[model samples]
Every structure is written in structure tokens, then in C-alpha cells.
Target: MASITASYPWTTAPLIAGAPMRLISGPSLVHAISAAGGIGFLAAGTDVSTLSENLSAFKSLLSTSPIPGAPSDVLPIGVGFILWGADLKLAVKALSELPEPPAAVWLFAPSSSEELGSWANGIRSATKNKSKIWVQASCVADAIEAIKVANPDVFVIQGADAGGHGRYASAGLISLVPELIDAVREYYGNLNGGGDTSSFPSPPKFVAAGGIADERGVNAILALGADGAALGTRFLAAEEAVIRKGYQDAVLKAEDGGNNTIRTDVYDKLRGTIGWPEGYGGRGVINLSYVDAIKGVSFEENEKLYKVAEGAGDKGWEEGNARMTTYAGTAVGLVKKVAKAGDIVRELRGQRI
Candidate 1:
């Protein structure tokens, strides 16, 4: 087996970089992160070209870095996939072709209870090793189902404050993380499975995600029994993030003043991306189009306006029409600068908390 490096939890680093500690998990942001001793994951969405290129880029960067345990204590980077939308065949192919296998795998937006199991099985089949799998769970039921089948190495409890598409305007991270942890301990510990002392071990540790922008949030989650923390809104403004300049600029311009961000079914409609389940909406700084159609108008009227905006092309957002809906989370207010991904990681890893 090829030698791999151990993970350095941000909690352990001196300075405990709060604002920048969130891991950048994708091919694009990997260089910035690994350089900072922070874990960066490869975001494998539907774009195969970008994914392939980024994977190669990551390997090249890794080859130049000093290897861990070989006179250097470096850590290998990780990979992330949207379990629901990802092309499984492509994922399997990636596992085989990458120069160095990923240090970990994170699955996003999984629905089926058994999907995780199938994913874990496929990963193990391809690598034939104990590769860690992390799954994002939107609710207790989702968490329970995923733990039942996939039994991931880590579970990310995503709250509504998450920027991307998440559960219906239901639970927020402040409430969900502890709730999920409690639910896991209660059911998995003593009910149907083992009744508090059953033969099986407890479920994998939990991680808190959504609206975690600083070390204070990190400390809060850690106190809540979460093994670690995952952040999306905190990482979106990083220089390495794939979002557009205008979007990044918008994020930097805001302040934590009020509830300006909203979750709505506007962006997916604009982008024409499929497989988005209903009741769940995306949260971001509300734009003119979103405000006019989603917030101001009735459901029927909004639907009509949305269709009209979709037909207008690139002039949508700029013209107050609606071509592309901006994707962001509530933390946009707290984000101010578009620093390098490494800087972001360093900030988080080096936080005082």
C-alpha cells in the first residue's frame, strides 16, 4: 500500500485559525489548503472536465510537497462528491486513475437509506482499504438511515443556515447538530439496535456544518460533542472558490446586520440543474429577481416571472430580471475578503479557541 498522511484537526493547531479553518474540498482549492496544512477536498459535481483536470493538478501539487512521515509530517488531501447528483461510474473511475488515492471521501445530499451503504461498498471494492466516508445528513431520519447502511466514518449535520440547497425551511445548525447527536446516542445506543448495551459499537462521530464562520462556532460545536466542524458559507468567499467575482464581491460587501439571506427555489430553476428535491431551498443574499418573484409575488405569479427570467439569458441578474440565481448561505454577511484557500485554512487552524 502507498503511504498516506494523517489528518491534522484544526482544533490542534496553535492560533486555531477561526475564520479560515473550514476545509476546501475540491480539486480547485486543494493547492491552497494542502499548502496550509489544512484539509482540502475535491468537489466532484457534474462537471467531469473540471474534475479530471483538478484531480491531476492536485496530484502534481502533492508530488512536489514533502511526504508525511518521510522527514516531513504532511497530510494527503481529501475528496468530496454530491452523492445524489454525482456520476457513480465517474467517481469509481476517479478512484482508479488518480496518482494518489484520496485521504477521505465526503458524500453530499444523499437521500436513500441504502445509498450510503452502496457507496461505501463501491469505494471499498475499488480501493480494497478502509477508506473513510463522510455523509451529509439533513435530518435525524436521514442520519439514521445513512448510519444504518453506509455507516460512514463521519456524519455532517447540515443546518438550514447552509448556503447550498438543504432541507425545507426546517432546522438550523444551532439546533440540528445537538439534536442529531442526541438522536444517534438514543436510538443507536439502546432502542432497536442494541438498547444501550447492545453488541454493536456506536455510530461514527458527528460533525457540525452550516453557518460555522469562526472559531467561536467551532468551539460551540466541539462543546456540543461534534468531533469536528465543516463549513460551506465560510469557504465560499475564498479566492480559490469557483464562484464568480461579482458574487464574491457581493459577499464581501455585506455585514451581519439582519436576515438578508433567504432560501428559495430560484437558482436551480435558473441553472436548470436537476434532481433537487422539493421542500428544500437554497439560502443566499436575496437578489432583485428572488425578491420580486419569490418574496413579493404569489406562488403562481412568481412561477410565471421565473420562467420569463429564464428565457432572458445572461442579462438576468444584472438587469433585475433573473437569468442565474446567486447561490450563497447566510454567513455571507460575516464574510468580507476573498483570501487564498490556504489563508482561510490557516485562519481556522490557527484560531485562539
Candidate 2:
């Protein structure tokens, strides 16, 4: 395994990442994380139609609030896309036109390795090979295939405990991280002198994601051979996160670590996001909506309930309405309060709590 700084020679900041959370991780959150010496990715998975508007917001924020220790001209942030749902050509074109161009492009859940490769090629061409490509893999098979085919610069190994959409068959971080590291090492070793293992190409850097909430989790993954740590749920409660008050409150109130969250497609169905690629399901806090769905509530009925609850706005949170989808990870118990994105980054990096 290589150090994140070694793999990404652009910055020497600590290897912590604010995992892209659709509709929640906006420019404000991304900038805050980057300013705190951790890498951040703007979530572009929700609306490609708003690509121009989003880029404008990012540019405005970059100019107004520059990263403290980094150069003011360049935005040390990246953009993430759900490969299966994104318009690859349009996304690449929009990102390439940016004045600074995103430092990287993170892709996940492609329909096929061929599609992933095509997107990688398109992004490299558009950015003149300046933007690093990071791919998320949930299992060893996918990791090996990604390394052999797409050849991304970084691979984020997501465990089953992840908050959002993830492979249905994924393993936990404890077992998955080391397994991936050894698999990649063996793959490279095999390519060099059959078994000598003396000389081999540098394998893609590894980052662990899913269920990692605090500094202890970060240290544990690093000890298991991950070059960095990518946090999603931990940042969902960040003050800059553009999430609903109910969602933030849900995370803070959660007490049942892994038991409270379940991997299911009920919420996706209710929200009409059932088109996600096969073999993927989102892990989120169980609520009345999920329970009702499991008990035979129709999708149309659930959608109606969700709309009414959404219309209630902040009052719904006060009423403890169960219509909302509170996406969270097993580490929800560790997120006790909402803080600034920078402070969250610093705390997770063991700088402060």
C-alpha cells in the first residue's frame, strides 16, 4: 500500500475524505472540508441539469473562501458522479470547462467495466489527464476487475455498513479492507516475475468507506492497510451539509448502532428512485415508512404519505413523522452533535473533537 500523499502528489494534507452525499454535500460542505486539510467531493449525482448552476456556486465559494493553508486560486475539491445514472459526456464537458477544473472525478456503480473504462477515458481526455479518477468497489471481485480494466488512480472500498446505496453482498470493513489490500498486492505480485514479487507496478491507492465515524475508526482502517478514510454519515450532520433538519436530528438521536439501520429498497421505491442498478441497496434508519412498506403498503400510498410529510416541513420533525428517509450508517451512535464541516474533519483526523 502507498501513502495517500504519495498516490496523490497534488497535496500533502491528511488522507481524509468527505464522501459524496447526493443532495446533501453541496459547495459549502465541500469547501469546509477542503479548507480543513481533508479532500472533499461535490456531489453531482442528483441533478445533471443543474451542472452549470452548481459549478457557478462552486466558483463563487472558491473565490470567496479560499482554503486556509492552500493556494487561493485552485479549488482543492473533486466532483463525484453515479456512473450508471450520469450523462458521462455532459458531466466531463461541464467539469472540463471550469476555470480550475476539479482535482479529481469519483465514479461509482457503473453498469459494466466497459462503461467505467469509457467514462475514465472520457474524463482523462476532457481534463487533459489532469483530474485523478477514483472508483468505488464493494467486493474483491469488483476491485480486481476495476484494477485490471478501468485502472483508476484510487479505489474506495465500501463495506456493507455504508449509509447510502451499496452492494447488497458487501462485507464489513473489518474483513473487507485487508482482503482487498492483499488481493491487490497479490495481483501486482503475480504480474512481476511470476512469483518473485520484487518489481511490480504501483497498485491503486486504497481508501476505506462505510460505517467509519470517529478517529478510532480512521486509525483502525489505516492499520488494516487503507491509505485513507472516506466518511459519509459522519459528515451528514455537518453544519454546512444541505440536509433536512429532521435528517440531522435523526442521526443525532440514533442510539442503536448497526441494529437500527437496515439495508432495504423501501425508501428508494417510495421516493421513485428504484432505477438504481441491480445488486445495490441503501442502508438507512428504519422508520414508519419502511415498516409500512414491509407490511404491504403500496408504493403509491407511500409516495403520497412522503409528500404530505415533506409538505409539513420543519413541523414534521417536531411531530416525529416517519415518512422521511433518514439515511445513516451503523456509526450513527457516535455522531452526538452537529458541528461545522471543518470541525468535523478536524475531529475525525484527531485534531479536535
Local error of candidate 2 at residue 244 (angstroms)? 1.3
Q: Score candidate 2 by lDDT.
A: 0.82
Error at 240, model 2, angstroms: 0.7
**Top lDDT hit:** 2
TM-score of each: 0.80, 0.93
Model 1 alpha-carbon drift over 4 Å, by segment:
1-28, 48-50, 66-75, 191-202, 295-324, 350-353
Q: How many residue pairs clash in each candidate?
A: 23, 0
Q: Please, what are the lDDT tens digits per residue for candidate 1 over residues 111-224?
A: 455666777778766555435677778788888787778777677777787776778755877778888888877766665555653344445667677777766667777777
Q: What is the C-alpha lDDT of each candidate?
A: 0.62, 0.82
lDDT of 1: 0.62
Quote the lDDT for 305 in model 2.
84
TM-score, prediction 1: 0.80
Using TM-score, give the best candidate's number: 2
